[model samples]
Target: MSSIFESIEHAQAQLKELAPNQWNAFQQFNELVFKEGALSVKEKEIIAVAVTHITQCSRSTDFHTKAAKKAGASLKELVEAAFVATAIKAGGGVTHGTHVHNAKKTDASDFLYARSNLQNLKSIGKNAHEGFKGYTQFNAAATTEGMLNTKLKEIIAVAVGIATQCPYCIDVHTKKAENLGATNEELAEAIMVSSVVAAGSSFTHIAKMIQSYND
Candidate 1:
């Protein structure tokens, strides 16, 4: 039986063949994103690893994991990055759940995202309350300092938020990261890293497209 996932070794020639200009452009952008600046290549790769987890792209995960290891990321550091992704992903659900309360309010503004919306979580259904508490514990544990520092974890969270495209998370974690002393340059690099990896998740699947066409 053929596997759905294409190996890392699979050629992307078919994709490049179909759109050489766009593919080449993406390559250039990807190269620039990984270049050392405020964040080292290793730091960028670790962010890519976290974004892959959020995107649930095995190809990106494999690619970034190896790149991270090659850049001297320890197993512990990579795992720490992954857990940050986990916390960010779970955070989206909890933050969005506030919509349930906002939906019931007759006076609620047309605006979808607001700091006030977070208040609704306190009124979340009892059935979900315990689960929410469990998530809170896990998120705290995952985000607190371990192999990675709190500032780096928050930076990873910012990147995952962008990858996951959660406005609340982007807003919340960006602030958290800033408060934790993450610089403008650092956050900018984090966003670019997220962008490339998110695109790469789709880019890697071109192999599957090639396989399907042949079969």
Candidate 2:
């Protein structure tokens, strides 16, 4: 058996040979997304690093971390971004705990995601107050102003929430980010960064696919 963790570069040449036009288009789009816009290149790379964690794309994490550093992001900023990802990802489950209370044999529409569902968390708080309290405290600490401001952290959270596909997180964090004065352009950029990184995560796995085919 061979290691599944093969280098993406090895497969890139193959991909280009197989689909030169699509590969070139992807390259251009990726470059454009990482280039300066509403967010700095540093900010976009940091967002990439943060999102790679939730996507669990080790290769993307390594690549984006280097890109972020090259773009002048400090180690502290990267770590802070990562923590924001952590908090947002974990928060999805915690917030979704509300569904447990309303579970039943019904249509999906019956359980539509309303922000009001978050109020059901009070029950979890009453039943598992200590654990719930602890998690909330950690979430607060992770997202609070530190090396990164609340706004940037919220933006990073939005990106992670998108990658994680956590509608609850998206709703909460986007509003929080807006309250912190994150512009629409900044939010759009964050959404696109998440979108591209998620796509890149799958793209880099072509190395594994190539290996499997050979095996």
Candidate 3:
């Protein structure tokens, strides 16, 4: 079997012949999205790293990990960006426990109503509540004033929460980001970055599918 790295290379090679216009469009979009704007290139790359992890795209993770380094993000910064993804993703799961407590069936409405019941965990389930507290502490340490400041980290967290479809996480981090002095514009741009990266990830993988069909 070909390795993932080999497969990525194969996909790139095949795209030029199979879908040149798509390949060019993807390249242009990648360049434009990461260009400096309201957010710095480094910040965008950090968001890319976090979103790639949320999407579980190894190829994207590898690409953005390198891109982030080139943009002057330290190894510590990269890892912290990844931890933002970890915390928000885990928070998504942890927050869902509220639904079980309310005996509420899962749906969009559950996410809206179940979130308010999270505090009930403290009274109803001490151990799980304690674990959640520890997780919160970990999240605080991971995102607060590190190589990346709390504001940027929170923005990345918000974007990850959105990409992961975690409403609770999104609400929590959006407020946190606002508290950290992130403007609405910054928050919106970060979300757009996530949207572009998510779409790009799918576009890149079409080449993989093409290769599979040809094989």
The TM-scores, one per candidate, come to: 0.92, 0.93, 0.85
The local distance difference test score of each candidate is 0.89, 0.88, 0.82
User: Which whole-number lDDT from 0 to 100 does residue 78 have in model 3?
Assistant: 89
Q: Write the per-residue lDDT of candidate 3 for residues 1-215, one digit (tens) a residue.
A: 34867876877788788878977887887787787988999999989999999888777888889988999989988898999889888888877766665664444353445557767556434756677678779777778788889899999999999898888888889999999899988898898889888987887688678768878
A best-first ranking of the candidates according to their TM-score comes to: 2, 1, 3
lDDT of 2 at 74: 97
Error of 2 at 178 (Å): 0.7
Displacement of residue 129 (Cα, Å) in model 3 is: 4.0
Stretches of candidate 3 above 4 Å error?
A: 1-6, 104-127
Clashing pairs in 3: none
**CA RMSD per model (angstroms):** 2.3, 2.5, 3.1
Give Cα distance to truth, residue 154, candidate 1, Å.
0.2
Candidate 2 — which residues are off by over 4 angstroms? Answer: 1-6, 104-109
Write candidate 1's Cα lDDT for 1-215 as tens digits.
12444332345766777789998999999999999999999999999999999888887887899999999999999999999999999999889988988788899889998877887778874658788789889999999999999999999999999988899999999999999999999999999999999888788777666766766
